[model samples]
Target: MDPQSALPAQLVRLAQEESFSPQRVLDAVHAALAPRTGVRRAEVLAHERGRLVVVARAGEAGPVPGACATFTLRHGGAELGLLHLHGGDPSTVDRAVGAAAGHHLAVALRDVTTAREQAELHRVTDAVRRLFEEGVRAVSVEAAGRLLVAVAADVLGTERAAVMLVAPDTRVTHVLGVGLPEELEQRLAASLLGRLARDSPAWQRAALTGGPDVVDAGGGPPGRPGGGVHSHRLRSKLKLPLMSAEGLVGTAVCGDVTRSRTWTPADRVLARRLALQGAVVVDNARLRELEQAHLRQLEHRAFHDQLTGLPNRAALLGALGDALDPVTGDGGVALLLIDLDGFKRVNDTLGHHSGDVLLQQVAVRLRELLPAGATGARLGGDELAVALAGPAADLAADLARAVHARLGEPYVIEGRTVRTGASVGIARAPRDATDTTGLLRAADEAMYRAKRAGDGPRTAR
Candidate 1:
């Protein structure tokens, strides 16, 4: 190969090799030129720390006065180094050779920079994957949101990250954050998303569009901040919408507190993914709460009377059984079974609708007369039971009288006054019967006796 052409070839080889070191390439350049061109000596000199240094040198020259030629190499219009030929002044071919080498050097530097960036990106991607896995495993929405913000802040290399919950009422309920003081984070969220809760278009755009956006407080163009006041000292923001099948749930916000930051594509992608995960988490939480509420309603219906909102027959029986138990049962339980004497007469005189109103009034009176630690339940059809604890037999008798009096009070049914009389039969645990069924049977018998005698109250013997 021609001596001048070989220099370019050497540059190509160096550029193709991995770990392209400037010193190594310079050494190769010198070695290739050593055979011809009377170049007894050659060196690659480049500026380092504001001073030129011989990066690579080959061969030796005893003396060469005014015989050296320095060829300045440039890349991307920036001066990088000079190729020094020591044997004699260079011709056009030597200058061309140095220019080719400089071009390859520029390409090599660019390749190295690209490779480093790619490696860093892969690391960031791995972090995101780990975060995704963690988010998927979280059982609660709050927990999942916390994990997302923490992971997103780390992955995006941002100052702060937050998950803001946008309630259906268009209010910001909760702000979950990472790497920020609670007060500042709250203020920051309120400034950005609080506006969304009101009449701000930024939030609507993000939520309706269901994508990520970068907003600069300075109101400058993309990646540039010209001049303006950053109201919160927040120079830049990246926000994405939290969405579910229902609609937009909330938003995931990331802020740069120190400087004006231009969000990269990777940052936007991470925000979108975090928002998506957050939506799923928030939706699941809402669904779980709704399910729990429905279950509670079912439980209430199962144990309560639908008509009067009191404990029904089955529930009262269960409670009575519990009261009869030796352990975990109340001390000295008194059972009173009351039957309204004139309830049937009232039902016949007025309509069943009026009967229902009377029954409701009766329930209310029974409840109002019940003492502390006592329970009132509607057994069925104007027959109600009351269980009281820690009261002597005499006190139980007095309570039964109070119940009768309360029930006997005038009830306004369908815009007319109505009256009823109550017959009470009282039974005490261990005095009447220890078992639930026996106690209930004794109470029932006593109540019938009260009705037969046509008295106010009767106690079991």
Candidate 2:
């Protein structure tokens, strides 16, 4: 118990032992002190990231009789942990000797912790690389999320993991998880995501991309929606913001379901890396969708009349080609080419804008008069064409009559009543011509004949 006798104790000789570990040193310290000073128990504890965790213990696991002295072990202004001697006479152990051992032990703890981190990083490098590349190869945001959840569960050493997508307005739009219960996932989406939004001063704590947050809930039962709570399940959780140069995308989360845990700095670093990589994946998918939409718009514009929103001349020719294909197409085809008698004069008198309105109205009438298996198109100013298949072409004359009625009806252009007439030309395939070009030529000639004769419509065989 004397201070001088503590000079040559087991703590000092621990360095020479090749098999010395933290636990071995703790046992040795307890053995030397308990026998000499009559202390019943000892424990080494460290406060890391605001949590007091037991590092090593020797002797009684049950409650000690009394709290003796608490020794502070620190090095370079950092508090490593505390060496607490429980029970027995406090003055019987040499305080100076314990203090010296604690200081030396603190240095060792730092080195050992750093080495452990390095070793773990080496072990998980390949797994982390796959997670990062999964984002690159992901076909969609949902696909990326599935990969992220699985990778997070594997990397963080937990049974459950999830990715919650947040909209620009801070709404959790979607939730994806692996090994997470449906009810628990829903609860997390509302409660955990809400807490992250509210408590964060960052993922912007105000923006969608908040900072990383890890919590140790001490293995308690999460709130049940409408049912009574029973056993404790989810304990520790880590949530990191999924962010990229494009801004906040969502959040990545994982947790231990079997036992309680506190996330260490290494765990946090891994989560952040995964979240960021997954963000790129999501952003790329969004960009891809936008590009696809734009391409669809371009394709529509290419084959459609922008003015009247109808198929253009090229589309009409395509329809004619399809209708005239002997093997695949209907047995016979008909082409109706209509030339407006007074539309040019109206365009010349009115401005182009008024002419456009008249054309749009003409398109509307054409669409209304168009039969179910027919193609209608504006073949350049005042010249419109209609193509129909075998059975439908039998109504070509009737369709021409309907067109005459619809076009001859007064059009209200710019609040002024305007009247126009149409000269119709009808040509049937295998009678007038079998090919689209010849059929169209015959229709044009017949239309001219109707125009010259000043009759309503004319049919060419």
Candidate 3:
């Protein structure tokens, strides 16, 4: 059987194997051509730099004719190489067979290249996802950017990578990178950092087109003339927009040359993927921070009274319990229950609005008279409670005098002088009553006792 006759089957088998290495295809071609023309040996030569280079050879065939059968490997009108079979006559049949094999080889090579590229894309995607997930766990944007840059550098075979975020108000681009040069950082900050953030034509184009912009850094667009800075240092740079469902978030830039370098299509694709992952990580981190802040605010509001901005009844009780704990020793917790005497009469004489002002004034006095160790809460209309810790009798007398003196001073509300007095009842913990509720009741009873005793301003029991 002529080797030329077997060329088609051999080429088909090679294509079926899905191996498109240049050397492997050449080997198959050589095998098919060896025995077909009664030639002792055969060789397959590929066109390189306008001349044939022997890629694969077999048998003892002497130098074959240069013009036997020339087959060009082409796809979409681009010539990749030419196939030259040796150790055979330059026959019409040989040319036809070589042509068929060349066409199949070209198609196979294209498919293999595409598959390889797709597989690489999937790998990179998985890596970026993992990086972002790790960033989310750490709750640090810098850490996330570091991982992103590290991955990009590894993928693109470059030394440096950077992630820049546009500030919300100033629109300045802030570098969020693991290992970026100081010069690059400064330049980005002083020049393109903020000035070109939201308005840069290159950035806008990438964001709108959903593609990357490659610039031979320092080459295009003249910088300050006679300036000390050399633009040529930044040879190649790739700018990839970080986009999310909300729109463009920021950009990821990577380069090899400290001053400049050239960028490739593969590098752009990888940078864009990293940017996408980084945006998600950053967004999630910010949301978590916001949620935590909101939760703290809610907790604060829960334990505080809104009207007076003071600790409420619930909070007062908690504080009393802590103060009265046996572990706290005999520090002595004192409770004073205060009632506004003749407050309703004032509300009846003036309007409710004026009464509200009077009540606010009274709350202020109580807050001032109460010591730092003490807390006060409004126990509903015309009534309030103050808790403190000190020597029982002395604290009681001191607080009662303070409240009476402050209240008697009077308040000027809406340009009118208003007068009010408080009747106070004092009780001590573990001395007057055991628990918080009992202490409060004891204090209330003492207050009424003072009111009945006809004691005017400084009455306390």
Candidate 4:
């Protein structure tokens, strides 16, 4: 074979023969090139701290120092290994030929290194994605935070990770810890999370700036205007702010007990990514909780009077309907309707604020005098109804007299003395008409009669 052509031919053959292991490839190159280079044996030198150390050799024996020509093998800007051609006359392998061979072998040497790096990237990405999905599926803010630290510990290869959730007022609501040291974990879990957010410079900086922080001290991360704010129980930590479009929601702290665990570029990348995904999960869960609370409040307002905080006309009618249900045997329920006779005059005299105060006081009085199984409800302005469930006949008479006396009591409104009177009317189911509306009508007419006659209470006929 032609000498020039044989070199490239051997190069291709080497590629085919070796399975891309660094040590094995070096041995293969030595085998293929020894006879042609005249320097018939070789040693592979690893680049370490600006010096090359002979790590492997192949063929007749290792090369003699200063008796060989060296080719620096490099991949990109980084040096991989060196090829030292040994024995015979080194001039037989021209500089150009040796350099070419060195370049090709360098590419081969770094093949596994590059492949492993890419594989690590893929692995990190997959782990982060899996955790993100799991966090999104979490049922509550606390659950999502717990899942975050648990999975992050395993994926990021750490024993301590804490999630600090911040409230809108910039208070630390929770600090959830997983795999933390005993003392520090307990402090963060039970004591520290409730502290003001400003106490931790590392956390607040990351939160406000929406960036990352490295706290490399034992006393804890520094504060904005002061030295280390508090003991984070961390020798070194990476604090990643969990940001949302709404703002900084929290911070995720991944740390170790010693400064020996340096936070690498890849570690920072993975932690920041996990923090962002976790922020979304936590933010969504919190928003859902807020929305549900608001909906419950709306439902309450729907069925209740905002002014006096009693069941409104609609709720009262609904309850009365339930009481009148044949399945419940009429509930033997009786209705007592009371109308404050002087409410409109007070509204005209003292303004609506004082009027509202009077009505609230009236409701309090009526509620206190109510029978054991009674419900007190406000049927719009100045008209209130009470339902007493199967009370003794004497109890019914007592409730009416109590209503008339208690509701007639004077009230103090905005430092002014005021008095009001309630006209009471009583009606019973199946006796004073069978339906809810009819019972209400009977009670209304009787209440008007009592008001006109100065009677304390008039039962529906």
Top candidate by lDDT: 2
Off by over 4 Å in 2: 1-34, 37-39, 55-58, 72-78, 89-112, 115-298, 318-338, 349-351, 367-376, 386-408, 421-460
Candidate with the larger lDDT of 1 and 2: 2
- The best candidate by TM-score is 4
Candidate 3 lDDT score relative to the true structure: 0.65
Q: Model 1, 136-200: lDDT tens per residue?
A: 56655567678777777887777877776766765766667887776766565566454345354
Off by over 4 Å in 4: 1-154, 167-200, 207-209, 215-232, 256-260, 282-290, 293-297, 321-336, 348-351, 365-375, 387-405, 424-435, 442-461
For candidate 1, the lDDT comes to 0.72
- Which tens-of-lDDT digit does each residue in 1-461 have in candidate 3? 67778778777776777455556765666566555554344444443323456655555556644444555678778765555555455463476776766776666555654666787688677768776667677444455556666676666665566766654432744565435567656655565555545565555666778766666655554323321122213356666676766667667765655544555455566666777776776666556756877887898788777666667778878878877888873588888778887789788988888888887788787777776777788777877778886554357668776775677677888988887778878888777787888888888888887667636432323
RMSD of each: 9.3, 8.3, 9.1, 7.5
Candidate 3, run of 10 with poorest lDDT? 223-232
lDDT of 4 by residue, 120-165 (tens): 6886788778876786677678887888788777787765788888
Model 2 sits at a Cα RMSD from the real structure of: 8.3
**TM-score of every prediction relative to native:** 0.61, 0.57, 0.53, 0.62
> Order the candidates by TM-score, highest first — what do you get?
4, 1, 2, 3
> For every model in order, what is the number of clashing pairs?
0, 9, 12, 0
